[model samples]
Every structure is written in C-alpha cells, then in structure tokens.
Target: MVVLTKRELEQIALPAVQLAAPPLALVPEVDLSAVEASDAARSAAARAVAKACEDHGFFKVTGHGVPAPLLARLDAAAAAFFALPQRDKDKAAAGAGGGSPPFGYASKRIGDNGDLGWVEYLLLGVTAAGAAAAPVALSEGAESSCFRDVLDEHIAAVRRMTCTVLELMAQGLGLDDEGVFSRLVLDRDSDSLLRVNHYPARPEAAGEPAEVRRRLTGFGEHTDPQIISVLRSNDAAGLEMSLRDGTWVSVPSDTRSFFVNVGDALQVLTNGRFRSVRHRVVVSSARPRVSVIFFGGPPPRQRLAPLPGLVDREGGRRRYRDFTWREYKTSAYRTKLADNRLCYFETTATS
Candidate 1:
C-alpha cells in the first residue's frame, strides 16, 4: 500500500543487463464480426478461436463492435490525466493513506522490494457479478468530472464487448451453452479490473551496450493471474511474448483490434489445454505509449478448479487443486510481480 513519490521513482536504477529482443511473430487474428453472422460462420470463427487458444494462448480480435470514437476519447482522457502535475495525479494514488480505492492509481516500484516499471496505472473495478458497479469517483472539479465521464463510458462499452468474446470462446471450446464460461466470469460479485496504463518514453542511452539499452522495460515479464485479459495498446511496438521453445516474439500493435490473452485461471480451468504465456513490454525511447487492459476473474468466493466437463474429457484427472480466487489472489500479491503465482496453489496427488 506504499506509494512512491516522483523523486523516489527517479532515484530507482535500471538493471545493469537486459535480455536481448526476440524475433518478431504475428499473433493470430480472429474476426469476431462472424459471431453475429449465420450459424456456419459463427462455428468457423469459434474454431479459429479454439485453435488460437490451444496454440498461442494469445490473439488479436477485430470486428469487436466497440466504436472507434469511444476508444479515441478514452485515449484522450488517459493522456490528459497522465499529463497532469505529479501532485494532482497523486490525489488518486492507491496506497496506504492515499484515500483512494483498493484498485486505484499505482506508480512505479509496485512491490516492497522496489521492483519498478517505467509505467504508472489506474486500476478500477468494472463489474460485480453481471451488473455494472458504480463509476469510479473522481475529485470534484470540472476536469476530473470530464475524465470520469469518458472513462465510465469506455469501461461500460468494453465490458459488454469482453462478455461477447467470452461467449464466443466458450462456443469454440465446444461448451455449446456458452453461459458456462460467462457464468463463471460474470457472476454477481465477480470481480473484474480495468487498468489504464501509461508508459513514458525512456531517455536515450546513446552508445550504450545492447544489454544496457535493453534494460529499460515498460513493464517486466509476467503472466496474468485472471481468467483472461483484453488489451489495447497504441502503436509503439513493445509487447512481446515467449514461445514454447523459449524464444521471444514481438506482438504486433494494431490500434483497431483488441489483444486477448489467456490467463492462469483459464489455463487451470482448461486443464492446461490453453497456456498463459509470459510477456513483457519494452520501453520506447521516442514516444509515450498507453494501454487499456480489462482483467477478468471469478467471484472472490468461487473455488477454481479444473471444470468437471473438461476433466472428464481429459480422462478425469485434475491438474490443479481447488482454490478460492481470494486465496490465489492473496498468494499472488505476496510475491514479486514476475514470479509464477500459480505454483503456490498447485496440488499433488499425495496432498
């Protein structure tokens, strides 16, 4: 709950060495407009989604029905908010004594160990069960009011779109009911987080060694701890994912599309059929970058385990033990940002 000031952030040093950039590969794209088409077309789109989930655990989505204008406004609002003076931004800081909500502004040096990223973010809860929660409150002022309005509108639209994608994913997984996934994710009391991230351009490290130059990261490598994440990033080229062979590939930045990533919860629910890929963002030295991510998880009280339907099809063996979302999230927050949080909840047969 500790918040670092701008001065403290500036004092943090970068790692002496950094990993080299990996080869670039395109993430598969799925045209979700098909979901509104005929049954045959819907089936085709579902199959494509299933394949992408099984093979890459990451993909880009197009024709998602969210208005481009809404995205632009959201982007503008974010840019305006982040451009504010440090003291103004600190008013929304999410830390002990910050007076902000639990899921609010977080600066660099996210962990107690001073593990830092070249980014700052505002996290807001988007859903409680299927219903929309109250819009995030902002300090009373004309500017804060406008920012709040735009963000609320954007969050509402994105939440609806995310649910649609989840339904299509369920269809592709042969869970014809579609509600199976949606029910688990959108249940009343289900907690979903919307994160608005801003990564400022790094200072040029002229003539520095490749390792030293690569040490600048917008955010470090890590897998998400939710059911799924829907992300949209401005054109800056930083997102990268690790392949099964341990090679890294840069993710394409398509402003018109949303990037979807399977998370640890989904991997467990699928009995590892889908992977939770490790990914990171490299800081750009020229222009600042902004991203909006919606992280979906089950209700805090819900116990997550391999879905019985999936387990039965996979010879009835559970790859992970049943654990409440609260328990898992608690464990996750206790560790370093990049650590494999899922390992703590793993259960062996003997246990």
Candidate 2:
C-alpha cells in the first residue's frame, strides 16, 4: 500500500559509473583443470576475496574456475527456455495473480501494474527439496534435457561462490563467522530466485516521444532488498548501477566473472556497515539484453533487523525493529514496490 510519491523520488539520468563504486577487486581466472596445482594459490585468492567482500558490497570474482564453454551453454539454454511458445511457457508462469516463489515463470508485467520487467523467469528456492530436485525438475520437462544439466551445474557453482561471499561479508562486519553464516544464509523455504531475462529488440521508434522511450525499459530502477545477488549476462550489456551521488555505471561482463552486488537485507543486518544499491537494466531496440539474477533471501521464519552488536553504543539506539523475513515478504506482496523508503526504525532500546 505504501508507494512513494513522484515528488519524493527524482527521475534522474542513469550514471556512467555506479553512484557508489563497490570495493572492487579483480580476481584472475583460475583454471578448473589444474585444481590440484592451484590449491595454495586458490586459498590465497579466497582470502583476498574475503577482504574485498568486507570492504565493498560489490566485487568481481575471477579464477575460482568456471569455464567459458559452460557459460556459453548456460546462455544458450536460457535463450532456449525463453524461446518456447507462450502457451508452453505459461505452464510455468506464476499463477493468474502471480507472487508465488520459485519453480515458475513470470510475465513481463508480473511485478504489479504491468511494470514490464525486462524479461521472463524461472524461480529457484534453496529448500531441501529444491536442492535435491531442482536439477531434475528443470531438466526433465524442458525442451532440451542437456541444458538443464548444464544449468544445474552452473547454479551449484554459483551457490558455492555465494556462500563464500556471504561468509566473508559476515567476517568483514566483525560478526562471528559461524553465527553470521548460520543466520543469514538462505535455508529451506528461503527463495533464491533466478530470473532468466531476455529483452527483445523493441521496434524502431518513428519519432516517438522521449518520455515514451523511458517507459520502454528492460527493467526499471530499484534496489534489491535481498542480502546478496549474483548476475551473469552475455555480451549484450544493459545493466547499470547508481552511485551514492547518483551517477550510473556500466557493469560489463568479463570472461568467467559474474557481477556481485549487495542488497538491503545485508545493509539492515549489518546496521548499514554494508550496502545494497539502486540499479536497473535498459533494453535496446538494436539488440536485446539477457541476464540471470539470483536474489537470495533468508528463510521465511528468520528475523531480520540491524544486529544489536552493530548499533550505536551511545545510549544503544537500535535503528531498525526486529521483523521476520516472512512478514517482510508478505508486506512486499501487499505494497506498491519502490514507492516508499526502505528503512524502518524502532524506539531505542535501553538495556
């Protein structure tokens, strides 16, 4: 129900660089073929990576070892999945009203009022069942069986990397590594949505109004509220991140490297020590953009708020009240997204 008034938000130009440049570290590509030879090298790389995660909400990871051929297969499979006829694709579509989690496809307008997100998607969850069966499910009913296997492998690889990133983020925030990992990591019923988006080339404009052009976006502007997100895309780059000063930056894809960004959940959990940023993907008339986004959330039952340890020590004011992830999800479903400020505050607690 809460939507921000147009006056509340400025419709500004996208920036050439992310408004807030993430602490970026370039990780060299590690050949998976020479795993044994690179053991010590990989461990050192991991430590360096952990440091970067602690310092910046975003980073570029390379050399951990995923192949370019595998990346190509994922790209092809994603394209193939979206290429299916509407009727066939509809089988996996979110029900009439949409809003269900994982294991389904969503239409362009699914995010309410036909917001026209840049692409369609297949949701993924981290439940025990999903973990055990996602590979089989995605592979079995698809038009191509091989694609599913490849996609599964990719997901598994990314999940491992995500864990490493999250763990490092926790350590960087000075939290007990195990506790942070146990608390913030996605769990059963926690949705790890994978949006496979394909932006079709819009028809050439015949002197259309520029305002109309703005509406023809692959994805609109907004910040992810999840703790972490991992993105992979082909050569067609349309993704942009807004910096704190409101400059936008292009995050291009390098071989074997996927773009990782922080989300709101981490910001709240770490009491603003980390950050989630505003971003969008624009579609083009000449060529379409394809991207895969994995939005990772905690299990529904988990409580989310600023960690007490991170609160201001003077008078011990807690900026955010404790709320359950399930409740937040419900609130999101009921509200007009992006219309309101994301921060929430509670009465200061005196202990």
Which residues of candidate 1, in runs, are more than 4 Å off? Answer: 1-20, 94-102, 129-139, 205-212, 348-351
Q: Least lDDT summed over 10 consecutive residues: which range in candidate 2?
A: 1-10
TM-score of each: 0.88, 0.74
Look at candidate 1 and tell me the lDDT of residue 328.
88
* Candidate topping TM-score: 1
For candidate 2, the lDDT comes to 0.58
TM-score for candidate 2, please give it: 0.74
Model 1 accuracy (lDDT, Cα):
0.75
Per-residue lDDT over 1-351 for candidate 1, one digit per residue giving the tens place of the 0 to 100 score: 223466654544334434555677778988988877889988888888888888888888899888998888888888888887776676676332224445567777555544678888777776553222444334557878777777767766667777777777788888747876667666767777778888876656455554555445677778998988999988877788988777779887789999989999988888788888888887745568899998888889988888777778877777789999899888887787679888876655521
RMSD after Cα superposition, model 1: 3.7
lDDT of each residue in 20-76, candidate 2, tens digit only: 333323332323233245657545544554454445456666554656787888888
Q: 340 in model 1: Cα distance from truth in Å?
A: 1.5
